[model samples]
Every structure is written in structure tokens, then in C-alpha cells.
Target: MDLNKIHNIYFIGIGGIGMSAIARYFSANGKKVAGYDKVKTPITNSLEELGIRVHFEDGVKHIDLAFLNKEKTIVVYTPAVPSDHQELTYFKNNAYTVLKRSEILGEITKNTFCLGVAGTHGKTTTSAILGHIMEPLKATSFLGGISENYNSNLILGDDKVSVVEADEFDRSFLRLSPNIACITSMDPDHLDIYDKPDALQESFKEFAGKVTDTLIVAEGLPLEGLTYGFGDSAAYQALNIEIKNGGYFFHVKTPTRLIKEIEFYLPGRHNLMNALAAFAIADVYGVSSDVIKKQLASFKGVKRRFSYKVKSEKIVLIDDYAHHPTEIKAVEASVREMYPGKKVLAVFQPHLFSRTRDFIEDFANSLSKFDEVLLLDIYPARELPIKGVTSGWLMEKMTLQNRKLISKVNLSEEVLKSEADVVVMIGAGDIGLMVDDVKFRLEEKFSLLK
Candidate 1:
């Protein structure tokens, strides 16, 4: 399908991070853009502010008349949307040119020099960093999270190059034809879709095969590529890492050159690795080491990827989108490294039932690293609840002595009771939406004590 021939673009789940990026892309390119989401959000609000039509209801009437013309309009929907969704069904039954979010992205970037960042974790940060590094070259980046530097997911650039989060959900990355790509990890996730760890690994290998120019992999991953990590044997290695002034200062050894004293502000060894990946990709694309170092230093980071909501001498409040066991462990390590000798409280909401059931023990063990734990019910983003799988069950498996199963209704009250010096809210669901309320209450209560 020729996107140039299309005049109106509609999305069934336009409020999603990825979907909204595409919506903004079309809107910026002068296409009549609109969509339907199950609910209104800050993302939907932003779209409305751009003069794009958005409505929460699922009826066909909510769609503007311009979008009803099948010849000129193409519909895009996320895999997370229900199969029976009214707007999606209407578009399909009406024989509109419908495509998945990945398909549309594939179409947009197929002809460009696409730098696809693929993995279970770190995709968002890695892609955002790459986008920032490549901004001088006019690379359009469609990121999975809000870049703190740009304040928007869509980093609008020219048509010659594109940066994208090569997602593995539903094997969506398979649709993209990339000139260069990197696999940050091959961790087993989305068990509801893959059902087996090997299947997920196979998908990564398939994506790696699609990279036409270069494939960069994290050190110790199963894929064979120009490796990047802290180890001496990796092609792109971050050596002599040190933490100072709330950030990392390190030297990177590329295949051809040694980039020295690169300063990165994002906390965590995992994030250091993410920076390394971005640096490797940009270096391969012929960006100067000095330019990559400058961009990495300037990149603020993606929102909710260890975002500091409240920070002071008395208390520190952090919000992160770490629903996976490995991600939680990374967050825990970063917190412990940043604030030693401080009592830490972790409030977690599991993301999906299949994921919770598949990795319950792992989740419990990871959360146990905190001094205190508050477990909320599973978010169940796209899956029905499984019998006997719940937060209470997860709480029982945790080794933490100070752990409680709490509800959102009483989140602020329970959090206020904690004597912990650091409070971290971790999840990928509406719990993110609840952080402002929790932050407000925490500030109010703590100020009274002062």
C-alpha cells in the first residue's frame, strides 16, 4: 500500500505509546488523523492538542466522516486490542486497508536505512539514545516510551533514516526490513504468545537474520554479532566504569577507536549497556565518537525507566516500568547502588496473568531484594486471569519479612506507613497512572513531619 496515496489515517488503539507515535507522524505529514481508544489518557490528550480527533467510545459513529471513506483511509490497530473490538471489526468488515501497528511502521521505514532495536528489555532506552545520536543525520525515530529529551515518542526527522523499537510481541519485528539492528536481550517473555522460551529465542534469531548491514548483540546473548558489554572480549566494551554525581563516567573501546570518559546520567549497569548498544550502532553508521558521546551525555532518558518523582535528603520516590523479573532485578541493583544504607520499599503490580504465572517465583525473589514490599493485583493487560494466580500468591513466595498485599484504594495509606527511606513504584499498568496521587500524598505526609 502506498502511504502517499492515503489521505486519512485511523487507529483503533491510538493512545498506546507506539500507536500515538505513528498518529503524530501522520498528523505531522498533513494526513487527516483520528482514532479510538478504550479510555482517554495523557497520550490521547496530547493527540487532541495536535488537532487530531480522538474519542474513547468504540462506536463507528465516533469516527469522523473523512475516515469513513474506504478508498482514502487506512486503519491501524495494536495487537493488544481485543479481536472483537467494535471499531476494529467495523474497519475489517468494511474492507478498509487495515494493518497492524508493526505493518504500518514497516511500510514507513522499509525504504529508509532502518535501525531497529529489538529485545525484551532496553529497547525503548536504546532506541531513544540512538535516535538522539542520529538526530543530526535527520533520522526519524519511533520509540516505545516518551523520551525525556524530546518529550514525545516520535522524533520527527527526514525520510532517509529511521530508528524504531523492533518489538517481539506477536513477532511484530519480523515485518520490518532493517539495514542495521541490535538485540539488547533475548529474555523469555510474552509466554501467552510464545508459550516456550525456545520459541522466543528463535524469534530473536529470525530478527537478527533480517539485519542487512550489521547486527549488534549484548555480550553473552545467544546470537552471534559484534558484541557490546563490560567484558574485555566484547568488540564494544565499556571499561573502567565509575559512578559519580548521580551518573556514570566510563570509556568505550570500539573496534577502531577508544572513546574516553563518556558521561551517561541514567543509573544502572543495564543502562550502561544500553548506552553501549546505541554507541555501537551510531559508530557503525559512521557517526563520530565525539558526537555519540555528546548525544549520550545529553540524552535525558525515557520516562518511567527509573524516573525520579521525588528526591530529597529525607526521602526518594522513584517510578519505573519494570514488570519483568530481570528488569526488577536491574531496578533493585540500581537503587541499592544509588542509595546504600537506606531502607527501600517496593510497590509492584504484576503486568499480565500468563507472565505472573510463568515467572511467579522469579518475581517474588526479585521483589524480595527490597527492604519492604507491597504487592498489588496483576494488571492483566491482555490476558484473562488464571485460577490460583494472584498477588497474594506471589506475596507468599517472597522472602522479604516486611511485605504486604495492598490495593490501590489504600496505596497511599499503606505507603505512608512505611519507614523506608526510598519508595519505588514498579509496574506497566494503570499503577503508572496512580503515581501522581501517591507522590502527592507522600509529599504531603512527609512535609507535615518536617
Candidate 2:
């Protein structure tokens, strides 16, 4: 559907990170945007601040009358929205042109030169990195996460280029047509939709076919494309890496040239690979290596990707959006590298019962890496709670000696009593709200008493 014919955009799940970014895009593009969310959140408040009308109730009665015009309005619904959602049902019955956010994203980037970042874990950071690189080089981008450098999720630039975090959720990335793309991982996830690991991998294989120019993947990903990594064999590989002032300083040798001493603050080897993917895509887009280097160093990472909520002399508390086992491994690996010999305590809230069931063993193995582990109830996002798939069930499988299944109410108290020097709150749920509280409690007031 042509967007010019539509004047009002109604989002069924507007508080979501992806949906909010799209809402911002529509608002910025001059469409009257309003949405209904099931709850009020910091994101919802921010949307209201941006003049996007957001109502917490799910009832159709609360919808603005302007959204009732089927011809003039477009209703966008997220897959997470319940099938019986009243407003969504109203839109469907009233003949409003309803579309998934992925379809809208497809329409948005169809005509532009899209750089799609697809993966289970690194999509947000890679897309934000590419967005930052492309924006200064005159490319517009819509990122999945808020980039700290620009302090925004939507970056407006000239029409020549666009960057998108091509999510694999519900096969969302299949909607994009990218001139160049990068897939950081092919780890099995979303088994509720995929049913098996091979199915998920097959989806990636198909997604790789959509790139008209080059497809860059991490070194070990199953996809056959121009590769980038720390290993010498990759077409574009990073070498001579050093962490200087908490940022990585590395030299990259691409197939064509050697660029020396590029920098970015996002820690972990995974971020370095993310940087490699972004560098490859931007370089193919005709962005100069010097320009790429400059933007890469200045590019602030995506929120919740590796967000440092609290960092003090004795304690370092990180809040990450890692939900998958692979993602947790990356977080644990990075934290351990940064603070060797310090006890690392991770409080994890499992997201989606289906996912928890799908990867219980892997989750258990990963969480066991931490010295102390606190598990919370599964955040049943988009999925009904499955039998025997609770966080407590998952906790029983963990090999970690120090593990507890605690409620959010008691989580703060549990954390307060812990003796660890490093605390990591890991999840893709509302548990991030506790980060600020945890930080405040662990500030100078709780200095090392030794």
C-alpha cells in the first residue's frame, strides 16, 4: 500500500522497541501516529512526549476516531499482540489496511539501498554501527535499538542508503531486499515458530539470497558469503587488537586494503565482529575507510546490547538484552575479560516459555559460567506458559552451585546480600527497570568495606 494515501498510523503494540522506532519514523515522516499498548512504560511515555498518542488500554473504545477511517488510516500490529486484541479486531473488521511492522519496514526500505543486519544476537549493535556509519555518509537508517551516539533510534539522511536491523523473529528479515547485508549468527532461536535448528538455518540461507551485492557473515556462520573475522582467512579480518581505555583498537585488512587502528567502545569479540560486518557493508556502499574508521570510533553502541548501568571502583553492574544462550556466553566472556578474578554474579530472567523449553540445557550451561546465578520467573512474552518449562524448572538443570529462583520482589534483596564485585542483570524483559535501583543501592554508599 502507498503510504502517501494514508494519513493516520495506528500501532497495536506501540511500546515495543521495533514498533516505537517505526512509530517515530511515521511521525517524523508527517503521518499522524497513535497507538494502543497493553501497559504504560518508559517507551510509552517517551512516545507520548513525542506527540504520539498512546493509550494503555487494549479496548477498541479507546481508539481515536481518526483511526476509524479505513481508507485514510493504516493499522500496524506486532506479532506479540494477542490474536484476540480488541483494537486489532476492530481494525480487521472495519476493513482498515493492517500490516505487520516487517511489511512496513519492507515498504520503507524497498526503494532505498538497504543494508540489512540479520542474526540472533548482534543485529542491534551491527545495525546501529552501520546506521551511524551510513548517516554521516548521507544514508538514512532505521535501527532496532537506540544508538547512544545519536541519542535516537531513527537517523535521517539523504535517500541514497538505508540501514535496518533485519530481525529473524517470525521470519521478519525475509521482508527486506538489501543491496548488502550481514548475518552475525545463525544460532537456533524462536523454536516456537521454527520448530527446529535446521529450519532456522534454512531461513538464513534464504535470507542470504536476497542481497543483490555482497553478504558478509561472521567467520563460522553457515551462510556462504564474503566473510569477516579475527581469523586470517576471512575476506575482511581484524587483527592486532588491543583494548585501550575500554575501547577496542584494531587493524583490519580487507581483500583490497589494510586499515590500521580503528576503534569502538562496545567490548567483546562479538562487537569486534559486529564492527567488521558494519565496516564491510559501509565500505561496499562507497564510504571511505577513513570515514568508516572515524565513525566507528565515535559510534556509541545500542541500548541494552551491552549497556553499562552501573560502574564503580569496587562494583561493575551491566544490564544486557541477551536472552539466548549464545548471547549470554558473549556477555559472560566480555565481563570476565574486563574484570578478571572478580566474582561475577548474573541475575537472569528467562523470556518466553517456548524459548525457555527450547534451550533449557544450553541456558543452564551458559548460566553456570557465572560465580553466582539468580533466576527469575519466565517472562511469557507472546507465549502461554508451558508445563514444566518455568524458570525454576530451568534452574534445576543448571550446573551452577549458587542458583536461586527468586521473584522480582525479592530479587533486590537477594542482590543486596550478594558478595560479588561484578553484577550482571541479563534478559530481554522488563527486568531492566531494576538496573537503576540496583545501581543506586550499589553506589558509593555500598563501597567495599574491606
Candidate 3:
């Protein structure tokens, strides 16, 4: 289990956001890193640019002999990887030292002063904001998504402070021993693994039990951690919120001192929660109130989380990585707050068959918030297509009279004709790659309309 003694690192299902973060970490630390992914993506491409060898095929024969050694090499596999995966099978049969990405993260940060962020939602944003604050103070961070502020998911630093998204999938966060941690809204998610909300809550409790010092829970999440909210019950609360220049202006009140007029550029009440959690960690570490205020305002945001594709008074396009029902509700509220009385069109691609089946009612209710809605077929990331579970089913349940299911082929055409004041794209799947395409078509169509 001595990571320092191992030199080679190989990853299966490396294209995932979490796995790719680990791949970058090992590669940056001078380990020979390589991985297998079914599809090449912008993430895997970034890893290759960093000199990490990545291949698309599942064939075990392509693995270099040097990386095949079972002793010096450490194999990391994602939970998404199939049981019959070729590289995984080879590694197991050859008696290689194998670990899940979570285990690897636990091992890597166990020696450092770990600041972990765990929850069903807002983990990425909270962790990134914490990382941004700590990075200025010379902290190493492993994030779930690339930070627009730093332009990278892996923040390299020599100091011991390390911020990371302690993931809940496969009970991953339980492996990490954190000095401080935050649990943002713990909605019932990943039902395929937990089967029920209480089971997931139990896991969160178990994970929170390992924090050595501070643990901040979001406004209303059911947990025993130090409460974080916009009210008095929490140790860290945001109050006197104001909206100025299309961003949020709020006060972060910690136990000792309250930092006023902290300007955060990220949207949504959920983002306010994210900032509160990050500020709580920074405040505990003796980071100056001025530093926290500065960092919170200047923090750009994580990619695909309310990322502005195109913005103008005439036409506004917002892209977000919101898959869960609660996240969608947050995004919708933020959109409404930003553009009052404007006709909003929300385009969503449901991710995962299991999720679609489990939260259909919640999804329907949340997505109905928009004035107009368009739903693409379910992405079905890993699971086989489930019977009676499809976008058509979801579309039928929506209360929005303007909503309809559109194929990716006709998506642009449908949007081109819509009379929406603000257009929002929300999903966590490959639907992101279509953002630029949708933007291009909208611009062209808008020009003609003008």
C-alpha cells in the first residue's frame, strides 16, 4: 500500500472526470501513467498532452510489457468499468496491486492536510472553490472538474493542504481521512448503488465520522456536521445577499467574525452554499477575511456549470452540468432570478437509465419550472436501455405545454424557431459537445431574425 514505492500507474475507464483527475495526479508526480477509455474525449486528450499514454481499445494485448508488472505498477479502475473489462481481468489474473480511484485518492491525500468535499450535488463546485482559495496559499488540490479560475483540475503545490471532491459513488468518500470536509445538499441519488435515501445518508454519516477536525454541512442536509447555511443554526452562514452586476453579493458569517460583501460570481442558492463551505474551511485555516473575500469574488467557476456560451441583452445562452432533479431546480431558480419575466427555454438530456427510472417524477417536476422545455433521449451512460424508461415517458409527464422530445438531429431546428428570451442547456452527458453547435446555429438564425 506504499504509493511512493510504486512507479507505474494504469487506469481503466480513464475518461471519467474523477478517474482523469487521479490520472493527472499520478502523471504530475512523475509516475508512468496510462489508461484505457471506450471513447476519446477532451479530458483524455488533456491527459495525453501531459504525456500520459491513453488508448481507446479494450484489448489487453496493447498494454506495454513494462506496465504489466504486478509489483511496481499500481492499477486504478473506475466503478463504471465493466466486470468483464479486459485490462481489469488481466490485472486481476496477474496479481497486480489494484485499487479503486477512491482508494488511491485516500492513500494520496492521507499524508497531507486533506480538505474533502462530499455530497450528492455541489461537491465539484465546493471543492473547486476551496481549491482556488488554498491554491493561492500553496495547496495541492484534486478536483472533480476543471476549474475555470486555474484552467486545470489538478492543482499542484508543495504545501500540505489538499482540496478534493470526496465522491459518494461506490462509497468512495469513506476511504478518505480528511482534516476538514463539507457536505452540500445530500439528495437521494445513485439509487442503483444505495437502493434508498437512508442508505446513502448512512454512508454520508460514515464518511463524516472520519473528519479529524471541521465538517460543514449544507443549509438543510440531515447530518451531524457543523451546519453551514444562510441562517444562525450553521457555524458558517451567508446573509444580507444582494445581486449586483449579474452575480451574487452576500456576507459569510463564521463563528468568530463575519466577512461582509463577499462577491461570488457563481449563481444559485446552491452556489451560495458552496461559497459558505469554502469560506468556512479557509476561515478555520487562518486565511484572512480579505483573502476569502477576494478569492470568492474572483473565483471564475467550474466548466459546464452555468458556463456562459453566449451572453447579450438580445440573446443569452447558459450551459450547465445539472443532471439531478435538485440541481435542475437550483439552476432554474438561478435562471429566473437572473432574467426576470424573460421566456426561458431549458434543454435537458437525462443521463443514465437507472437515474431516469428512479427520479422520473422529480425530474418532471423540476424541468417543468422553465417556460419552455426540450428533452433529448436519455444518454444511458452505462446501463442497458430500460423498458418503459425513455425521454418520451419523461416528456409526457411534463406540465409544460411548450415541452417536447426532440432528436439530436432536429434539435437545432427546433431551437431556431423557438421564441425564448434565455436559452439554457443542462446535462452531464456528452450533450455538452453540442453546445458550440447549438450556439453557432442560434447565432446564424438570430442574425436572420434580426
Best by lDDT: 1
Cα misplacement distance, residue 277 of candidate 3 (Å)? 1.1
Tens digits of per-residue lDDT, candidate 3, 1-450, equal 778899899999888888888888788778999989999889988888998889999988888777987778989999888899988988898888889989888888889898888888988999899988887788888888889987888888874878889999999998899998888867799999998658998999898889999878876776776788877777887889998898888877778777777799887877888888888888887788888888888899999988988787778888999999999999999988888899999999999999988999999999999999989999977789999999999988888888988988988788878899899999988889889888888877667334
Please give, for residues 1-450, the per-residue lDDT of candidate 1 as tens digits. Answer: 788999999999999999999999999999999999988899999999999889888898778898999999999999999999988988899899999999999999999999999999999999999999999889999999999999999999999999999999999999999998999998889888898659999999999999999999999998888999988899999998999999999999989878898999999989999999999999998998888888988989999999998888878899999999999999999999999889999999999988898999999899999999998999988788899999999989998889998899999899989999999999999889989888888888778334
lDDT of each: 0.93, 0.87, 0.87
* Candidate 3 weakest lDDT stretch, 10 residues: 441-450
Clashes of each: 0, 0, 0
TM-score for each of the candidates? 0.98, 0.97, 0.97
| Predicted candidate 2 versus true structure: per-residue lDDT over 1-450, tens digit per residue | 677888999999998888998898889888999998888988889889999999988787888888888778888989989888888887888777899999999998898888899998898998899888887667777888878887777887766678889989899999999989989888888888898659999999899999999888888887788998888799999989999898899898988989998888888888888888999988877889888988998987887888887777777888899999999999999998888899999999999998888888999999999999999899987777788888888888999889998998888788988999899999988888888877777774476333
Q: What lDDT score is found at residue 214 in candidate 3?
A: 81
Could you tell me the lDDT of residue 127 within candidate 1?
96
Deviation (Å) of 259 in candidate 3: 1.4
Q: Ten consecutive residues with minimal summed lDDT in candidate 2?
A: 441-450
Backbone clash tally for model 1?
0
lDDT of 3 at 268: 81
